[model samples]
Every structure is written in C-alpha cells, then in structure tokens.
Target: MLSSLALALSCLLIISPNTSAAPNSVPAAGQSIPLIRRAQPERTVAEWESWAKNEREALTAKYGGNIEKRSTGTNLMTNQNADSSYFGTVAIGTPPISFNVILDTGSSDLWVADQACTTGCSKVQLFNDLSSSTFHNLSEPFSIQYGSGAAVGTLGQDVVQMAGFSVPNQIFGAVTQASSGLLNPPVSGLLGLGWQSIASSKASPFWQTLASSGLWTDPVMAFQLTRFVNATNVNTEEPGGSFTMGFLNSSLYTGTIDYQALPTTPSYWILPMKSLTVQGNSITIPSGSSSYSAIDTGTTLVGGPSSIIQSIFAQIPGSQPGTGSWQGYWTYPCGTAVNVAISFGGPSWPISPADFQLTKLTSSQCVGAFFELNTGGSAPNWIIGDTFLKNVYSVFRFTPAAVGFAALSNTAVAMNGVNAPAPSPTIGSVSASATAGTGGGSNAASHRWSVSCASLVGGIVVAVGAAWM
Candidate 1:
C-alpha cells in the first residue's frame, strides 16, 4: 500500500460497543440520537473561543479560512449576538447556554462552556444558565483537548437544528473551559466531523447518538461547502451554506454513486492503494509503508513520504529546481507545465495526469501544489486529492461499516481497482533543485520502479494534456 496523510484540527469521532452503550439507547430509527440524549451541562463563551484560535491556525495554512471574530451588538451577560456568515450560534452544556461555533471538518470534538468551567470559560462568551427552557443536566462530566487547547464540560443534550436536519434532543458539550471558542467566535460551539477527538468530550450526542442507536440507516456522512461572501466574513445566511452528514442533493452528481470497498484504520475510513505508478514506471519505496490513503473532505493537500513523492516527480519533465525550502515548504520553477499520471490499486485502474497535478496557488508558477502535504509528521503515505476525487466517485462508509471507491473514467478499466505495478526505489527527499522528469527508470538498488504508462480504461491514456479538472 502507499502512504497517506490526515489533517483536521477539531477532530471528532464517536464509536462504541453496542453492549457498552448508555442504557437510554433508543432505537435510532425511532428518533434522532441527539434528541434522546442523557443530560446537559453549563458553559462559558470564553472557553470555546480559545479552542477556535489554535484549531484555526492548524487548519488555515493547510486548507483555507479565517478564525478571527467580531462581537455582536451586546456582550455576554445581557444580549446574545451572532452573524450567520462565518459564525454559527448554538447552545452547549447541561443547563445549556449559547456560544459561537465554527462548522469545521478538519477536526472533530464538540465542546462548550460548563458550570465547572472557570478561567477559560469566562474569557469569552458563556451560555447564560437562565435561558433555554429545555435545559437539563446530566451527571457525566467530560474533558477534551487538542494539540494544547483544552475544555472540560458536563454532558447534556440540546435541541440543535441546522440545514433542515434537526435533533430535537441533540447532545451539547457544555464545556466549563472551552478554548476553541474564546474570543473570535464569542458565539456558541463547534460541530466536529473530522478524525480526531478529546477522548470523549461531548454532551450533544450528535452523530454518535444517531449511529449508535441505529437511528440512521447509513453510517456515512458527507459535507458540501459553498464558499460565499457577505456583509461580514461570515458563511451564515448564504444561499449555498455549508451542509453536513448528508449528500448534496444536486443534478450534477445524479447517477449510480459507486462505492469503493473500504477498510478500517483505527479512526477514519481508508482506501487501500497497492502501489503508485507514474508514467510507465512503478515508483518504488520502502516496504511496510502506509498501504492506504484516506479520503478526507476536510483536507486539501495530499501529504506523503518524501522519497515516494520524488519518485513521481521524476516523471514531470522540467518540474525540478524547486528543491529549496521556503519556511519548510518546497518552491519550484515559476512556470513549469504540471502534468503526470498517478495510478493506485494495481495497473488496471490509473489516475490521469490531470488528477495528479494542481493549479498554481499564486500568479507565479504553481508546481506540485495539489500533492503538497506536510509529511513532517510520523507517517509515510500520500493523499489522493482533487486530482483523484474530481474524476472518481468516492464514498467513505463510516466505521464498522464497509467503505468503497469506484472510477467514472468512462473507460473499460474504469472500474478496475488498479492493476499491480512494479515497485521503485527511494531516491531522496523531495527538493526544489531536482526537476520533474529528471530521473529515468534506472535504480541504484535491487528494487526497481515500473511505470503504468498506458491505460485502456478511458481509451485516452494520460499521454499529456492541457490543465483539466
């Protein structure tokens, strides 16, 4: 298998053994999970704001967006103010009060101010205990932290409604010490759908509640984001708002939404990739590497090992020369035409060159930006990004549920999971000085790389073409 990377700040994942679940496990089909939650908590606005700050930085550089926030007409005690543009206001905790929230996928962890919350909760907005007629408290108290940010709140449920999908008794975090929602979002809370979490820090019983109780037939949840601009840098109130846990009911993607069989990888759904084929050669790497890639809606760039990446770049003629590091980021030529074919699975199904390259970020030359991910971490793999998803239909069946993938290349081998290709040797760390397509097929070691040059799937092999989506 090849390498893959995962990057999302506000990570949230909910899974549990059926027998070990809460006693109040109402049949999921009977009602929504959040609607039937156990209890609620109290929260302060400042606690959540701090969390937003750290999560925002980890998210912005890799993806895009701003974390800074402006207050409404009133402060915390008397009046609650929020702009629906980029901010979302929601209740949190047992005796739930409202706080600002950011709809994020980069990471998942539901947190809000709590009665036990002290300094952090007081830093920003705090859910006023006096309001919310449906507020109730549960005995379960939880704590969650990311990187360094942390929050502690009692478990509870709230009636959260958004995008027409509602959980009347939706669980709330009600963090007593929320760091992600401190100032910028002096609003309410966050909805986490990424692949990380604070052990078990939630009161809103969101997706976990629904999935655990079998309320929802499908375990898979998806997001569709429509970037919009308005009076404030807010994404709220926009016609095409951010949607979650559902499909984007649209005409463009109306057809058999093929599913690619998937495997479990601890948390996220993983698509196993037997090998990576570049051009007509198989790029070789060390054995026992991360054999699969993750299909993350929250991640933008694909991250992977340096050696494997350099192997692919060996095919992009003239793409070398950016070996220099810019604040740890590699820089390349100003105007090198980006093109190449990346094949996963085996040799049968191959990714076209168009799916392998990304457009330039700035007006200057954009070299290998799509596959540009931070591999500085402890993993060795690659992320199949826009170059891959735009052409194929990807379905991430949730955990304990099967995951799958399928190609829509409009070719004979379109459905081929990818044929076996030769493994190549590791060259060196990717560098700007090395040009694309510079290295040939010869290897210094016994291990060799085979290129899956021709593809019969689409009848139009990745010979080379103008930039296409």
Candidate 2:
C-alpha cells in the first residue's frame, strides 16, 4: 500500500560496473513509450469504478494489517480525479517539459507539475524552474498524501526525456501544492515503479535514476495493458499500450517470462501468493504480513479476503450481493462460466470469464471486479489490479528485483476491446457448479443475485461502466 501511486534490455548490451555507463562506455538499447488509456471527461466508467472502490476502502481503513508498509518519512497518495489509468511520455528539463506521467508499479516518487503550482495544478503541464537550463534546485521540502488529495513540494533535478532516451540528472517532485485528486490528473505526475525503500523523494528512485544514470540497456521493465474492450468509447483517451524501458518486447509476450522473486521487502511489487482458485474452490486465505501479494499497476479492481471473498461467491452459479448503490457489489448471469485462479509461485494463473464481467448491470445483468478487502484486522493484504492485469504480459525486473507474467501479446491479443480470445492458462482443480446464461433471451430466467459478507461489507459505491483500464 504505497501512498503516491504510482527496464532495459538487450540487443547488443553489456554494462555492469554496477551501472551508470554512458560517458562513452556504450550500452544504450532501451526506449519505447506510447502507453495511452486517457478518457476522463470529468470521470465516468462508473467514476473510475468509484475511485477504485474508494481506494480499496481507504486501504482497509488506513493500513490495518499494514502489509508491505514502508515509509522512509514522507508519504503521498494523490488519486485526484484519477482516470488516466495508464499513461506515458516523459521529457523534463533543459527546455523539455512534456510530462503526461502515471505509470505506477504502486508508489516510488518522480513527481512533476511545479511552476509554483498556482492552485489545483490547473490540469497538467507545469514544471518550469525559470524555463530550465537543466533545473536543479534541491531545496528539499515535501509532503504527499492522497486517496483523493495532497501534494506540497520541493526537491528537483532535471533531464529526463523518454522514448528518445536520455537520463542526465533526473531526481523529481516539484509540485508547490496540489490535491483535488491532483486537480486535473489524467496524467501529469506520477511515474513510480515502486521501491527505493518506499521513496517520498528521498531521491534516487526514477528507476533508480535510470539504472544509476547509464540509462538502460537492460535493467528490464515491461507492460502491455491495452484492453479497452469497447462498449463504445470505453472512456475515450485512446493509444492503450507500450512502455518498455530496458528491453523485453519479444513481440509483447507469450510462453516463458514467468519471473517472480520480489519479497526481500523493497516495497510494493511484493508477491508469493501461491493460490486463490475459485470454481474449483480453494478460497481459504488470510495469512501473514497482511497476506502479501501486491502487483498493482495503479489498482483498478481485484481485491481480496472478506472471508475469502465470501467464499468466492459461496462457490458462483448465479452470484449475488448488490443493491442500493450496489452495496459491496457482485452480480452474475452474463455468461457465468466463472473460473478464476491466481498463484504466484508459477502455473495456476487462469482468469477470463469474459474477464470477470464487471459491468452490464442491467439488460441481462453483470458486475464483479472482485472487491472485498477487509484487511482491517490485517494479515490479509492483496491488491492485484487491472482486473487481473489486463490478462498479462507484465515483466518489471531491475537486476534481480523481479515481477513477471506472460502470454497476452499478439499485440496484446489485437488490442482487446472485446476482441477477447488469448488468455487461457486454464486451472480448475475443484469448484465449478453454477453455470448458466449462454446466449441471453429469457433474461436467463431473470437474474437476481445475493451473497452477503454481511451484505457486502461497508463503503458501498458500485459502478463499473467499463474501461477503467
């Protein structure tokens, strides 16, 4: 649960003197930025799924079991108007400015938007340090806090520029003051990739200042989000995927990539979950360190533990629990062939039941991005978002930092917007008896649902219009 929310590879590469190569030591091969998903005309897709279920009910009431909690001193959370979901495009000092951030692996700083902020950061583009000549005023001073607001600011350094590569100095955060969920943020701040011991600008965490300044030939980082699964302008913004830093693009992913090793406690990408089967039931969760498991690309859904998500729909057929602003939401009947699976030590993966349906709350019904996070008692922390990470092709390595997952890369299954198909690692060991709803008509015998964890826990605010990518 980092509060700020949130490469390099190959092709003739070799540079390890503990990094920082570029003074002519060669290296260079790493760059590619497109990552688009913009749409946020003042928030929709059910207001970004009701602000990601109100930031997972304010991180289960502010760190209850406190899983992976790291703070180094300052903390930030800024989910202001959120909605850009996944963004890209860097460029910083010496006249660069460009911006458009938000690529969080769930927290580590790299802020922006500081021409002395002025107020609610006026929708994007700022950072002017008196028109830059490689700005560097590290006058130190900071503060970040968000689930909806706060930014303050100080610290600085320059030269970042992406795609065309270049690192130069790169320390970040400039803000001046912000909040209002980052006033106009659909991207213009946030580029963390996590771990620098939970950085709040303690500095050296912009991909470890781009691999100690050598700028990347392979410290590895990869992602291929896409999935707008169009139900018409699924929010709009466009582009969708691509953001490789060091190198992994073996055409986006398929077969062998797996990687995992993260929990030496660096912060956020933490893993080791090992099991979660549904439809073949294996639910019994809630374990140590708040139940480890984090993988959050800026979280958009998929949570856990409310008694193993109410014993995973009490084990699926016509699932339920949803009413009056859909309290704790959950619904079914669209094509209910539910399967769900998760494991992190390898094999078990599976997901796709039309990616767990999440929307259609009428005209034949549907809803369910899997939320239930009552970690309030702690030791049950789980987040894994992008509704199962857009079906996979992830990879986030920093030397041996680790976090990988593959399959989904025939250009991300042809930019899924319902092109569907491609994400079948299949897994079903035991729970499968609740399937019906094959082609609509007869409204599948009028779909009525219910599954109370005491009527879906609390902070109820359901809304899954779709494409909260």
Candidate 3:
C-alpha cells in the first residue's frame, strides 16, 4: 500500500468491524476500511516543491518506459495532474451512485465521469448508466493514455461499493472522452491497485472481485500514509491511515514483516533494490542489471535512474541541479542534515530526511524528494513514491506474490534501535510565509475531521481495473 508519515499527511478511514456489518452484506474477511488520505494541498515547502516538480515531470513523461507495455485490452494510468493524488468514496450503480474515486496503485482501469463529460470534465460525480437499475451495458471500447491526459470509455456492469464492501456485477468505466487531468481537483475516477496484469479492461481489479467473490478472506492490501506536520498538524482523532482489505493489521505494525519475493514480470509491486544511502554511505548505481524497485502507491515522487538520480544528488549537502520548473530536480539546501537510506534485501531502511525534504524554496532553497526517472532502457527502475512510503509498514500480499515491510505506528520500536531520532524537521518555519492556495474540492473537511469516513457500502458500484496476466 504506502507510507512515509509526515508532510501534511491526512487519510484515515479505519474500519475495524469484525462482525456487525450487514445492511447490504459483505464485510466478513477481517473487516478493515479507511479512507481520508490527503497531502498535496497545504503547500509552503516552496509550494509543495513546485507541485512536486510538476508531478515528477508528469510521471516521467507518462509512466517512464516499459510501464508494463500494455496491449492486451488497452492500457491506462494517464494523468494530467492531481497533485499528490489520493481520494476515496466508492458507491456506483444499482440504487447507489456515490463517486470520488482515484486510489491507483499505478494504473489499472475503473472509471467515472460520464454523462458524456463536458470538455476537460471535472464538474464531478457522473456515471448515469441510464439511471442504474443494476446497469450492465458492456459495449466495451475503453481507452486510457496519460502523461497529461486521456480517457475514452464504454465498458459497464455496476453495483460496486466500499467499506462495508459489496461487489455485485462490478466491471467499470464510463467516461466518454476525458482529460482535464481528470477534472483536477479531489479526484473523480481511478482505483487500480495494479496487477490484474495492467488492466485495460482485462478485468479483475475491484479487490480482485472481492478476493474471488468469497468476500475477501485475504488477498491482502495494506498501506499507512499519514505525515502531516503543518497547517496545524492534527495527529489523530482516530483513523490516520489505512486501506487494509482482506486482513493483516497486527495492530497496524511494528517489526518482523520484511518479506519480499515478487516479480510476476512488471506487474508493479516490484522489489530487489539493495542500495542508495547518503549519510550512512552507500550510493552505487553503475547498473548493468539487478537494481529494481517499484513499491509505488501510485507514485507522487521518488522515481529514479537519471544516472541514479545523479548519483544520489551527488551525496547531498548543498545539492543542486534543478532550474526552470525544477529541471531535473535534486535541489536541496533548506535545512539540510540528510540521512536517507533504502536497501530492501536485508538491513538499512531508514529514509526520513523528513521524508527526503522538499518544499521551502527561498530562505535558502529546499526540494529533494529525488526525481529524475527516464529508465526506458529498463533495469534501473525505482519509483518508490510517498516519499519513501511514509516511513514503511506496507504489505500487498496476494497469496505469496509478496511485498512487506514494517516500522511505523510510533516508530516501530525506535526503528529497531540503533540511534533513530533523525526524521525530525517535519517542516516548520522556513519563515512559514504561505501563498500557495488553490486547494479547491475533495478533502471534504478531512473526511469528518478526526476520523470516520463512514463506509459500509450499502450503495454498491465497484468498477475496479488492471488486467494483463
């Protein structure tokens, strides 16, 4: 799922109801639902590092190379810009009709915004499959192409929901020509969680059809994501971060997760890494092969291989290079102390230079979430994102397709002890200033500010996408 806890973090829809969850059925497999993730509006760290260097150069120019080179059904994962991107609220078809979508594990299918969209669409909520009655259309004809925009649309089915979790019919996509960076506000469509193969309608997303329709006994999917510290950092009135589905919440983590093994051939949750340090040393990247990485909670910043991020920003210190819309970016200088780590084979995980420092741009420059990416030649992947996964505690599973990690939920024992402090500087006063504004829509008041985005899905409509294998 994703982590890296502090940088305006916000999204906690924790639903731990083991029983008592009927009303529309489905919610038995270790029940867990949470939705309220925000962190890309509250800018100041130099305007959220210039909108994360234009969303990492529009996701390395639309999904840097070998992005699972799709063709089976149609490819997807196109974006125009949704700064930091993350949204919730599902409900689709039948008597239901809610819509807020955009969860993405880096490309799949699911869709929304139909009513024959209107130029650059985004007036929000739409998808009237003839006013639903368990809609089912299937005229097929979907499309997706992003680097800045695109979405065709046709497919159908319906009755999907979330939280209380239902899953009748399913399928998804309705749009009808979109591309205004997907309406660019809160989020209007998306929820792929990768690996149904790359779904272009190859199907099987929507929680793998509720984990094979058994209603999720465990197909696995977990994420944490909460790292706010500015605009009045509100730690937790309750749900701070969660997306668990089908189980594995050992009380939200703390040590012994590690796990690994996963490489079903470019299907996303990739692994292998084994390098990239800075204050603790290491920084190789001569690459000839074996240097993978892809965790990607639908990426936001961390991409890689522009010469291994210019050799880890030439070992940070005054770090520079960026220019004009953050040229290739690497800009650091704001409160430099830097530690940064990332091994993923055994030891070293660290990463908390306040999650790779970014934002703050004049009082002495700032910006460094490491983004260079152009890996087209393959091998040098990376991606990572969520500023090093909000500080660990991921999962992903799927019957041993693996990808785990631990250490969050109160520093997982001071990060396994060895002098952990670090992580500090959750961005405080680079003179504070302000002047970013433009937050428009979605965040719906922090989803009940303090927790409870209320989800038990009585109004089903689960579209889901990502089909390849």
lDDT of each: 0.39, 0.59, 0.56
Give lDDT tens digits, candidate 1, residues 338-394: 344443442234444433433343576444533333332322244444344434444
lDDT of 2 at 321: 74
Q: In lDDT terms, which candidate is top?
A: 2
lDDT (10s digit) by residue, model 3, range 1-469? 4555542142323454443444666644445443335785565989889889678767876876322111101011112121243345567776776675656666656778788877656566678888888887877677665333467767787777665565566677777777544444444677677666556666666765555444454567677655542213232221224566666667657667887777555466778787768887788854324577767665555766678788787887678876655666667787676788887776677877765765556788777767665543332366676667767878777666778888776633232212212221111111111111111111111100011111111121111111100
lDDT per residue as tens, model 2, 1-469 = 4334221233224334344543435444552222345785787788899899678868976877433221111011122121225566566777676676666776666777787787777767777888889787867676654333456677777776555455556677788777544534445677677766556655556565555444455667777776563245444355456666666778767789888888765666778687788888787665556558668676556766666676788778788877665555578777677789887878778777765666676777687778665433322267676667778888778768889898785766776554222221111121111111111111111010111222222332221111121
Models, CA RMSD each:
25.9, 27.2, 27.3
**Which residue ranges in model 1 land beyond 4 Å of their true spot?**
1-108, 112-130, 136-156, 163-189, 194-199, 202-205, 217-219, 224-250, 275-282, 285-289, 317-328, 337-363, 370-394, 404-469
- Please identify which of the two predictions, 1 or 3, would achieve the higher TM-score against the true structure: 1
How do the predictions measure up, each by TM-score?
Answer: 0.47, 0.29, 0.30
- Error (Å) of candidate 3 at residue 39 is 64
Best by TM-score: 1
